[model samples]
Every structure is written in structure tokens, then in C-alpha cells.
Target: MKNITPLQVAILVALATAMLVAGSAHALALAQSRVIMLSLITGISVLAMVYYAINYFIYRKIKLIYKTIRSTKTLGGGEEVYSMNEDPIGQVYDEVQQWSKEQTSKKEEADQLEKYRKEFLGNVSHELKTPIFNIQGYIHTLLDGAMEDPETNLNFLKKAARSADRMEALVKDLLTISELESGSVKMDWENFDLQELLQDVFDSVDHKARQRGIQIQVKAGCRAPFMVRADRKKIRQVLVNLLSNSIHYGNDHGLTQVGVYDMDRHFLIEISDNGLGIEAEHLPRLFERFYRVDKGRSRSEGGTGLGLAIVKHMLEVHGHTIHVRSSAGVGSTFGFTLDKANG
Candidate 1:
């Protein structure tokens, strides 16, 4: 009865009322019953027709409205609208409320994405502008009388070349990130000695470390060669970027060390520096592009501010993640893990 339609209930009420009227009139008198009976039959017939026509029109309109609402739900990518047993109007109200909430959530997410997009564009522009402006200044000075002065001519040319190189590095890093995000970078996987790779990186950056009196060495237990499977070129880039940061950010005569740990099927690698450590607040955002704890010092060290960002992406491509632990004045450690080569 609870699931019965409004039209069914209306028909039931009309029939019950007609039966009561006929029963009461027949009890009044049996002599005039024939005349009353004829009139009663005619009235009942007319009432039945009127009730049927009215209910037919109302039910048809209600069904059409339900179908329209169902079609709307389908277009909105909602679940299949089921046949309503009780009240379709109430169900429609509930669905509309749910859709409104979902739309509000989507709007918030879109707003956040738009904000990030704008921030990224601004950062890129600032990074490129510095080098471009420096190059223009150097060229203009050289063109003005410095070109005729032998002492300043070669110096200005070198400075201009360096600025151009910085711009080139920035562009290259940007391209690499774009390729990585677009899934266009192909990994060249191979089994290689992790210890040997560290040595190569150390040798590559030895001169730079020496200029600042920094000592870079592997931790004692990690000196042994540990084989891992990964893209050799990308891993090399990761190592270079991490080591370069340590060298650039370390204090004079500071120590930078890398440690290795065996974690069953994986190897954990940590690059640590006892220099100008990062504050705890900055650790979460360390991998964001162009995010610098010390912007002036970072720029002075000739970095494109994309090294750590690239490092994070490269590791992610290999199904890995990088983490950082740091304190303001004590030290900083960056760690990542790679799969061990199968026997």
C-alpha cells in the first residue's frame, strides 16, 4: 500500500464512496428502488469515466517528468536511475543535492590547479629573465668601449658566454621535465655497480668540492660495490644533481657523505651534508622547481634551480621516491631507494 501510486489511491477512494451511497439509498425504500437503481447505475458509469480520464492524464504527466529527470541524470554521468517504487519527486531532489555537492568539489580542485599553473609560469619567467638580462648587459657593455679595451674584451665575452650557458641549461632542464611528465622519456635499464657510479660522480665534482675545501666520500659500510637495476643515465643525473647541491650549499671545509643500506630486495642510498642544513619548514617543498631556501646563495652558485625537481621526477619514473631529513644548523640528508639486481 505504501508503494501504491497516487492514481490507484484516488480510484480506490472513489469506488468506496460510491458503494456507501448506493447501500444507504437502497435501505431508504425498496418501492422506488427501480427508479433509484436506474439513476444510480447512470451516475456510477459517469463517475468511473471521469475518474479514469483524470487519472490517465495525471499519471502520463508524472511518468513523462520521471523520464526527463532520468535522462538528465544519465547525461551527467550518474549511476543508472532505477524505477521509483514510492516517490520520484523526492528521489529527484536527493540526486540534485548530491550532484550540486560534487560540482562544488570539482570547482575547488580546478581552482587549485589553476593557481599552481600560474605560479609555475611566473617561476619559469623569473628564472629565464635573470640570465637573459645578464647576457644583454654584458653584450651592451662589450659593444660600448669594452670591445676596444683588450683587458675587458675577453672578460666580457666570457661573462656573456656564461650567461648564455645558464639559459641553455635552464631550457634543457625544462625540456627534460616536459618529456618526463609527457611519458616520452625512455629508460635504459641495466645492472650496474652503485659504488662505482658514486665514485664517478665524486671524481666528476672533485674540483668543485676542492674549491670550497669540502670532502666528499662514501660511508665506510657502503664502499663495497652493490649492483642495482635502473636507467644508468638517469641515475647518473640523479647522483650529479644531489652531489652538486651538496657542494654548492656546503660550508667551506664541510663534510658530505653518502651511505648505503641493504633492505632485502632494495638498496637505500642517502646523500648527507654537514653544512648549511635546511629548516624543517622547507623540507616538504624542497623538490618543487625554483624553490630555494636561500635564493641569493642558490643563484650565486650557478644553479638553474631545477636540479632537485628533475631528480625527483627521474626517481619517480623508476618507481621510486626521494625523502629529505634536515635540521636548521646540524645537517641534511636526502635518501632514495632502488631495486636490487636479481641473481
Candidate 2:
């Protein structure tokens, strides 16, 4: 329709048939010139009929598909231009199938995200409700003539204060995660002695570990300092969070150990403890916000339930990752990586 007419296309097809037969005869060395002439004439006649049938029936449908795809999709230069000389029907079919799969995959991911969002909101509300109710009850009791009794008043006030503190911790953790996700908190990167930092964290929590009769130490071979580049404060937070969690769950007279292993370009830090380990099923979602393996026990532990989530975010900001492993009665191990420091 644009440049070449249907008559011209038929003429070209006829000429191509003649040339093809002539070339075949020459290549075969058959020396059958009359045979070549008859073949060309018959081939052209058959080709004309076939071409008319295709153009009138099949070509219209194929061209329609091509046009529909063109109209719907923004075809960049990578897309082949539609032409009668080429069959693009197969390519179109494959592309359409692939597009359908991609859309389906996107929908699945969207549904998953939506589900997570609902769970997060519900978790936040549920977490806040307990402390809020406790505080409300304590204050109401104090106001209802318990204020006259110094013993009851003082005890209720202290309980109310603890509840308020729990709410404060929850809110702070929520802010920290929000800040981390929004990239509002910047990592201050530098080289630091990894072993030295671990000592500081242990000393800070020495009393808590002592109460459990649990000993905290670096693995035997990992006492020496491993220089690494990362945000010092954030890494320390990661250490404290993981180590404290280990101590809280550790068995009496058990051990919690930190290990640093040499990876080619990074150091892997693992915190392992002989504690009440998590179930296998909870491992996958252990890092998720407010996802507790033992919800009742976890709430009693006075944690905002965001420690692991915060640790994950802190390490991730330094382009690193953290992982955990556990067995029912054996122990749990958490591992993470950091870039090696330059000399």
C-alpha cells in the first residue's frame, strides 16, 4: 500500500521462482534446460495461487495482530518493523505469552506486599494496645482512692511508668525503622577494630549475661582484631542487639560466642549461643517486623520486638546482610558480613 503494489509483488515472486530453478539446474550439473524451463513455469503458477490464498486469508489476520501489538505497545527501535517479506507471527505469540506471565508475576508480588502492609499495621496496633491499657488501668486505680494509700499509689505509679517506658521504646524503634527505610539516617563509615568493639558490647551487657550464668566471649580463634570498614555506631548496635538476644535466650551455664571468618573481600561475623533455639518454621520470617517465634515470651522480655529488624536495617545500610539459624533445644547462630578495611 505504501510503496510496492500487489501486482509488483506477484511479478517479483515469479522472477524469484525462475532464478531459483535456473540456479538449481546449474548447481546440479543436470544439463536439463527444458526441465528447468518447465519447473520455473509450474513453480510460478503454483506460487501465484498460494500467494493469493495467503494474502486473502492468512496475511490479513497476521497483519491485524501486528497492528494491534504496535498500537498497544510503545515499540522502541529494537522492535522489527512489520513487512510482508517476514513472518513475525511466532515472535508476536511468544511476546504476548511472556507479557502475560510478567503481568501475572507482578500481580502476585503486589498481593504479597499488600498482605505484609496489613500485617504490619495490625502488629503495630496490637503491640501498642497492651501497654496503653496497662497504663490506663494503673492510673485509674490510683485515681480511685488508691492515691490515699501510699503503698498502692507508689506501686501503681511505678507500674504505669514501666508501661509508659515500653510505649516509648516501641515508638522509638518504629521511628528508627522508618528513618532507615527512608534513608534519612546516614551511615558514618570508617575502619574499626571489630574484636575491640565486641569486647565493649560484652562489657556493657556483662551484668545481664552474668544473671543468666551465661559466658559471652569471642570464638577461640577469633580474639584478634579484624579491621573492617562500616558505621561504628550501627555495627555496635547490631552487636548489642544480637548479643543481648542471645543472652536473653541462653541456657544456664551456656555459652554465647562471636566469630569472625575471612571471606575474600569481606569478614563474616557470627553470633552463636547455646540458647533456647527458634523453630525451623520461624527462621524465614525472623527478621520481619514484630515476628516473634514465642509471642508471649517475647513480649515478657521487654523488647520492642524490633531489635532484629533494626539490626538488619543497620547492616543493610552498609551494603551488608545478616542471617540466623536455630534448632529447637540446641542453639541459634546469626551471621552478617562487612567490607574489609584497607591497609
Give all candidates' CA lDDT scores.
0.84, 0.85
How big is the positional error of residue 2 in model 2, measured in Å on the Cα after superposition? 28
Candidate 2 lDDT over 8-124, as tens digits, reads: 566667777777777777777766877577667867785787578767776677768766765655434554554555544555677778666767888899999999899899999
lDDT of 1 by residue, 78-176 (tens): 444434335544565576677667778888999999998999899999899988998999889988888999989899889889999999999999999
Model 1 clash count equals 0
Highest TM-score model number: 1
Backbone clash total for model 2 is: 0
Structural RMSD, model 1: 4.5
**Model 1 alpha-carbon miss at residue 10, Å:** 4.6
Report the lDDT of model 2 for residue 197.
92
Over 4 Å off, model 2 = 1-80, 85-92, 262-265
Cα error of candidate 1 at position 294, Å: 1.8
- Candidate 2 Cα deviation (angstroms), residue 136: 1.6
**Where does the lowest 10-residue lDDT sum fall in candidate 1?**
78-87
